[model samples]
Target: MKVHLLIQRTFAGLNTEYTSNPAIAQLDNKLFLTDERSVVMQITENPVFSFAKNEKWTCYSFIKRALDREKRAGFYAVRLFISSAHKLTNVKDCLLTIAQRYEFFIQNNTPSQEYTDLLTQINEKAIIEKERYTFDIESIRKGTYYAIATAENLEALFADERNEFVEKLYLFTTNIDSKLLAEFHLHSIDPLSVVKWQINDEKKALDKLWLENTAIPVFAKKLLSLQGAKLYFQLKGQQEKRELTGTNELKTTALIIDDADKCITSLKINNTAVKPQPYFELYALATDTLYYTLKNGKEIPLPITAKLSTRKLIVENSENALAKLWVNGEELPIPTGKKFEIYALTTDKIEYTIVGQAGKKTTVNSDIKTLSIHLPNRGQTINDNKKSPVIDILLYALLSLLVGGIIGYFYRSNTSEEDISAIEQKIQEKEAKYEQVKKELNSSQILPNNTATKTVTSTTTNTIKSNNTTTKTTNVATKTTNTNSKTTK
Candidate 1:
């Protein structure tokens, strides 16, 4: 048997053209049509209709178009036309069964439930939109199942199931055409897999690599070298000290002398199998004062100024014996007992010598000097020529006189200037006071002279008034007398 299918892509509210055979011309303008071969058919006006065979068309045309146009495409409406040489019951059953089975297949294979429900609802909606076309099963190949899907709704119908269908066909089918399978090119390789493979390769390379332990050996060698040198110097010093001391027990005293003046600032004595008295008494010649403890617990002061010269012992005081001087098993002769001073220019190499009694009496009392004598030629000399005592005294006296004269001159000049300024200030003040007194005296003379003039004028006016009053009284008496005489007549 053979089945013929027609798929179409049409816009909404538009008619689509499809044909199975020339005898199917009755499908025009018809909502649904059934043939004598028990074929049931339906025509749907829904533009979203899609079938599994034509799934790619829906994705390319309708779904993409809808997305571009920003509109929602409805469920796929497939114009299913089922025909068979069997009875209508068998044909309907077979068609419905296929439809139901395809719905289940799509739902299982698809990525989303919404698309499966849409396809199932499209199948159920076929009865109402009855513009149907029918076909006989004999018209298609025998035992072949055919499906038609319109391109407009292809994406909506098979957007999720396309890849799954391709995979199934690839896995199950034999003698499948490569071109046909390639049409549904849907499988995509994951990009992260490639990156992960590269990272794994790099990690393998890093695991096989090695690094040298350079720092540890270098540091250890440096430390070992330093330790060896330190041990060498310590051993050398011990050897020198052992050679310097014989089998006899000797007390050792160390003194640190300053390089500038060769002054001894600190001293330490180490006595083993030797008495402290011998050590103290032996080293007393180093300084002017030697301090010792008496049996009464009193500290006694001894003055000693003697030093060892080249193979000879010299004492500052002639009473001190120099013939018995022997130091470190070396015998020394007695000199004229004149004190000789030694000096070192630089601090790098210090000179040290030992002095003791010449004869081995096994217990000879001796004195040693730990002197820090200053070197005359070590530092720069301002005056080299030695002057007589009288000339030095005269020079000191002249310098003092010169300094005193300069100081006295400065002091007298400063005092005289201050006194002159004070005297001038006093004279100016006294002259100002004299000028003010003269002005006051001239003003007093003018006021008294004007008052005396005013007094004389007042006295003259009083005398004239008295004389006029007397004259008036006399004239009035004469008039009265004349009147009385007239009255009598």
Candidate 2:
């Protein structure tokens, strides 16, 4: 984090011209104040509040009130300093009595909860006095920098403050440009109550602050850049244990250990955690099987009753290409020029190998220990496994036919010729009945009365023609007889 300090000037009755300091810059997690006298003060990872000259008094007063409020809330004010003209001096002790007397003024003020305990410790070990240290023109000119230090407990400063108490003092001599003065400064002076110790312990103190105050969730996503094997914290007893695995994304899994010491778990892809479930679930996209090994045995078998609900393998092609699918180590033959959807429900890992006629190829393998639902080429998705009712019915019918065929095969092997003939006759009878029903069904469109009428009309026309032909024959016979009679007469 980088912070910029801007200094400006303002006078009571004159136009205030200000010069900005560009040479001095704060970087990283540290603050530095330097002067022409070669005196420098450094604070590591300190939170500094800056203000314009016009706002200096208000800001200083706000900080004072904030400190006093924290003191009353139970935090101990440790060391206060006003730094300027090549020196740092303690001024907190001078205001301690005033703080104690006016401590009630900050009774309702809001200070961070962390400072409360320190202030209480400070007030407990202090005496109240009526005189208050006041900041005036002379004091402001002498002190160009101010700082406050606080601690939750007093014992922290016993070692360092005892030896360096005198060295912390500062002196002012010559008049310097107002621009050189810090825009705002205040310090809480009490060795036992400074909060510096907590800040010094960066890992313990700042880590919590970072987790709570910073965008750590976003940073956690960026942590995926540190790919390959990584360790994550998991609860084991009252302590956290590092669980290591190879991953390309941030995923959580439930750690399960079998009696044979084999580990089984699940993983999430793209950092998408399983929702509405207490434990994380991983899905294989291209496979429809679960992988598991028998305890103390190397052989893995697909249970006969194992079924998958959310697994499918799909292939799509527009040309003559064979797509090969492999479950575990078995490769499936896929014909070209057709799309296919295959579902395999087994208790083992399924590996899908896809090859194209045009040299395009891909392989996807999923561990059965983790539930994964994936698709290849965004082509097709396999959802939860559901048994179709029609398929179930067909399976039952086929099983019945197979059983009957087996029984009939054995029965016929021992049967006599008469019995065989009788069976053949019965089959023929059934075939005839079936044929009759089929014919009736095929001629269902023709009415019975219409068929009968057509038949009767054809019969009547044939009979009439026959009768005319007979009459003609008889007439010819008579004509021949008359001709013979006339000739004779």
Using lDDT as the measure, which candidate wins? 2
Report the C-alpha displacement of residue 150, candidate 2, in angstroms: 40
lDDT by residue (tens digit), candidate 1, 1-489 = 123222222234222333343343334322222110111111122222222221111111111111112243322222343332211112223233434443564458654322234334433542222112121112211111112333343233233222212211111111233354344341221111100000112111111110111111111111111111111101111222111112111122222222333222222222212123211223311222433332212343334323211111123423332334333444444345345432221211222222243332322212222322112222211122223346434533453454344434443454344543443444345446534644563354322223332343344345335444554676689899999999999
RMSD of each: 42.7, 23.1
Q: Which candidate is the best by TM-score?
A: 2
How well does each candidate superpose onto the true structure, as a TM-score?
0.12, 0.19
* Regions more than 4 Å wrong, model 1: 2-26, 33-86, 90-93, 96-489
Give a tens-digit lDDT track for model 2, residues 166-251. 21222222222344334233222322221111012211211111111222221132221111222333221212223323432323
Per-residue lDDT value at 92 in model 2: 38
